[model samples]
Target: MPSQGKLYVVGIGPGCEEMLTLRARKVLESSDYVIGHRTYLNFVRHLVRGSIVESGMGREVERVKMAVELASGGHVVSLVSGGDPSVYGLASLVAELVYRNGLELDYEIVPGISALNSASPLFGSAISGDHAVISLSDLLTPWQVIERRLRKALEGDFVIAIYNPSSRRRAGNLRRAMEIVIEYRGDCFVGVAKNVCREGEQVLVMRASEVAESGVVDMHTLLIIPSTESIVDGNWIITPRGYSRKYELEVE
Candidate 1:
């Protein structure tokens, strides 16, 4: 065993064991201490031979600090996050704390499939074109900033994938987002993928107007609002990547 310990910020990939990358699994197996949110830890608990540390939401800083301290003490640590760590995950937190404190530590970020990746296929090729992923949760980001981003992305006609569309505390945020959607692209195809790769997975493709009217969404839901040029065809949301526009196509 090495004398020095290292930190690995691992993404477990949307709560599915199969979605866990090989590097992520190796890092988890090699860890002396595995720390992460309780729900994310449960997904890879089977592969973790080390001691597991569980924390609930809003304790991200505490978890990263504990992992750092453990690593500094010569213990290899794996800080787990659901989905790709770079995308709204714990990797940035680890980096900020380490750099800000000027701590001498070795760390690596192992990427994994994000919720956007896992949820994309449920809507066919909805994300095949230019797309924007925005989280509707205004906990860290201001709602005004979110609205501005939504407006700009929709104006540019980028397919928009919304994360954290709603929560018990912020149930109206998704409605607010839909209002913006209506303003830019009215009654467009909207795909909702809930629970993603986890159990109780549900997928729905509906008109933007319908989604706005029903207001059926939650924190677990990912809403894919396709560009105005896209359309719903035979239960699939297809966003063309400009191929038909360039080439002469014939029906076979």
Candidate 2:
């Protein structure tokens, strides 16, 4: 058996190649093996060399095992995930696998832009205050847990960013979420960003009441719900009173 090597879990940002950070690009070019879902693999095809493993949907565990196995055989492996590695990405699973298997290997997580950050600028300052990120897919988690979190977000008056809001089989969750939020915040700000950082990106900024009627959002879309204090500012929507000014003072 070959000596084990290091594993680098890299985030490729959203879907745009240009959005890829310099370190992520470097790791991809230098790694001996690359592993990721088909779409994510396609996104970084140009940057990768050596052997590449393309895992399709519903095969995440298998993909992680493959990457670990390759790395255990002395191959420098780079595992790619979309958005931030820590946010609904494969980093946690990979770490769990390594611990369970009792494999001694070095690994690092490279951060990248999450959908929330990518979509935030579209809606004027929706996340200027405190907020939460929730994934509505309910694959690993139960729907009840998701609902509870949604309720907390509403009651706390926190801006919320929802990922995997709707899919073909789970199409009505977003509407349900809006219904719950409306009960707490009668009329709030809502923004939808579709295919962010991709070629056909579109941003829609509207009232939360209008989101259900807009019929323009999808699974690829990210929903940003602004706090009560958020407001629209021309084409650039943002949350005011950022911490930058709080820390930086003007010199006389």
- On TM-score, the leading prediction is 1
1-252: candidate 2 lDDT, tens digit per residue: 556587899999988888889999999999999999987888899888777888898788898888888887788999999898999998899889878878787888888888987778656455765789999888888999999999998778677899988877776787788888788888666778989988679887777777767877777789887766666654456666665557765578
lDDT measured at residue 156 in model 1 versus the true structure, 0 to 100 = 92
TM-score for each of the candidates: 0.94, 0.89
lDDT of each: 0.86, 0.83
Mind giving the per-residue lDDT tens digits that candidate 1 earns over 1-252? 657989999989988889988899999998999998888888999998999999889898888999999998899999998899998898899999989999999999999898888887877777886789899989999999999999999989888889888887887777788878988777666898888888888889877767646656777788998887786885688788888999977878
Compute the lDDT for candidate 2: 0.83
Clashing pairs in 1: none
Q: Model 1 TM-score?
A: 0.94
Those runs of model 2 whose alpha carbons end farther than 4 Å from true positions after fitting are 1-4, 233-236, 242-252
Query: How many residue pairs clash (N, CA or C atoms closer than 3 angstroms) in each of the candidate models, in the order given?
Result: 0, 5
